[model samples]
Target: MVFAMLSHAAIAQDQTVIEIQSPVLVIDQDRLFAETRLGSRAQADFEAHAQALAAENQRIEAELIAREQELTELRPNTAPEEFRAMADEFDARVERIRSEQDEKARLLNRSREEARQNFFGEVAEIISEIVRDKGAVVVIDRRDVFLSADRIDITEEAIALVNEKLE
Candidate 1:
């Protein structure tokens, strides 16, 4: 009876020692955006629009400077009331143009953000497939994890898949 009890205890210990695989995984989301082709194209588009806006700003500034110079030249010869009215109109135009340009800048930023959000949405199915393949129950952003084994960092693998799967 004593021998049977000892043997049963040993078997229980062996069963308890069986390895349990980790269900969590990590991905570097920023790396996904920078490394994937989809992300690169989006970034390029945003940058191009931003550069165009900057050029437009410079052109508007040049035109305003020219207008101001013309107004200043006219001040000496023109009637005082007429010159003052022209100056006020110029100030009003400057304010209106400035407001419009600011709105464009804001819209550009908003579009970029929407593009980023759309990119992530496009990648969600890919991530889901990866999670299924890896038998991972949950995937957390790498930035959120305090410490994790490098083996669990799937950003590069995911990037390769994204590049292959996406245009």
Candidate 2:
């Protein structure tokens, strides 16, 4: 009888009380948005580069159009052999420009990938530091956690730590 009572008491003590709030994850969402917006220096650079590339492409297209018009106007007056040579030259130039544009696009993609890796590395480092400081065994997304007390909400603290590092 004593063993049965002791086992019952132990089981009761091990039970957890759960209280869930629908808006609990909102706190973490705000912190994440604020931190991401503040820390996205690479993102700004990427945008600027993208704009420049687009402008250059537009300019190249305009130039090609003008060149094609000039070639067409010159065609009716030229000897057949000379016209063929000029057309060949124009084709070669267009091909070269296409190749160069492909290379430029590849370079841009590589640079963006490198910037992404660097940004994520910094974020992970800041999060690890916050985890250590907060004595949290593991951190999960707020949406995944079923319930926890207000004391367990460390999202703002982690965001602050990330912002400090970003600055």
Candidate 3:
């Protein structure tokens, strides 16, 4: 009896077919490719900027460290006014470095925002074209779609169509 019940359950599971009405078509290719290219460009730009900043920071930090070390070693023989002047200079340098870092961060954020907008614009254009050509009643994210027939997967066609436009 238990074996029979198990067999019946398995057969039911196999027969189960989910159907989606007004099935949502996802243009993942457009999102994926567009975002990928934009992100790559953004990352490249970011990396280049970061490397420049890093090199500059390293030079500044090394200079500051050397100065401090020299001051420490010379403290025994150094005059009070000279020591005070060196300390003040170090403080000024620190403030300048902090301000520069803050400005770079703001610039990086602005660049990223611009890149994201550009990627979205490219993706939207492809989606519009696909909708016009394929007569897609609605386009939705794949995550929102519960089930769909394989035949209705217009993703490849949409990708091809969009690539043509891109080229």
Candidate 4:
């Protein structure tokens, strides 16, 4: 009689366990960005800016190398105090240039981040519309998931929507 009672209670408990039936959607942000027109434009612009900065850096580096060679050549012929002053001035200049280069690199990184934020801002709205249309209760990045069927992936759909909206 006790075993029958316990079995009935267990069945009741199992019946009470609720299961979520909501749909889940997945997006591949990297693919979406690369495939979208606005994202492609942003990438090209960023690349051009990076190339320009690199060329400028190379020019500055060449100038510094020349200055260093000149200073080395002058050290042998110059008086002790005069050579010390020149050496100190050269060291100060090199430090200043390094600081400037560091600042430039930081600025480039900031610009890249800003561009990404702006791109995502626009993409978010489109994603929302797609999510609602598909009746998905939750959205997850494709990169974060270990496994998902292609049918559940919304990256291509999101990319299409983004391009259509942006264009």
* Best-performing candidate as measured by lDDT: 1
Q: State each model's CA lDDT, in order.
A: 0.90, 0.70, 0.66, 0.84
Q: Give candidate 2's total backbone clashes.
A: 0
- TM-score of candidate 3 relative to the true fold: 0.59
lDDT of 2 by residue, 79-148 (tens): 9899999999999999999999889989998998787666657677666666565554465667766776
How much is the lDDT of residue 54 in candidate 4?
94
| Best model per TM-score | 4
RMSD of each: 6.9, 7.8, 6.5, 7.3
Q: lDDT for model 1, on a 0 to 1 scale?
A: 0.90
> How well does candidate 4 score on lDDT at residue 130?
80
Which residue runs of candidate 4 sit more than 4 Å off their true CA positions?
1-22
lDDT of 4 at 166: 92
What is the C-alpha lDDT profile of model 4 across 1-167, one tens digit per residue? 99999999997665433112237878888888788999888878888988998999999999989999998999899999999999899899989989998898899989987888899898888998888877777889899999976667888888888988899
Model 2 lDDT, full chain set: 0.70
Pairs that collide in candidate 2 are none
Using alpha carbons, what is the TM-score of model 2? 0.64
Instruction: In angstroms, give how far residue 23 of model 1 lies from its true place.
Output: 3.5
* Candidate 1: residue 50 lDDT (0-100): 100
Candidate 3 Cα misplacement greater than 4 A, ranges: 1-39, 131-164
The whole-model C-alpha lDDT of candidate 4 against the native structure comes to 0.84
Candidate order by TM-score, highest to lowest? 4, 1, 2, 3
User: Per-residue lDDT for 78-153 in model 1, tens only?
Assistant: 9999999999999999999999999999999999999999999999999888888777888899999999877677
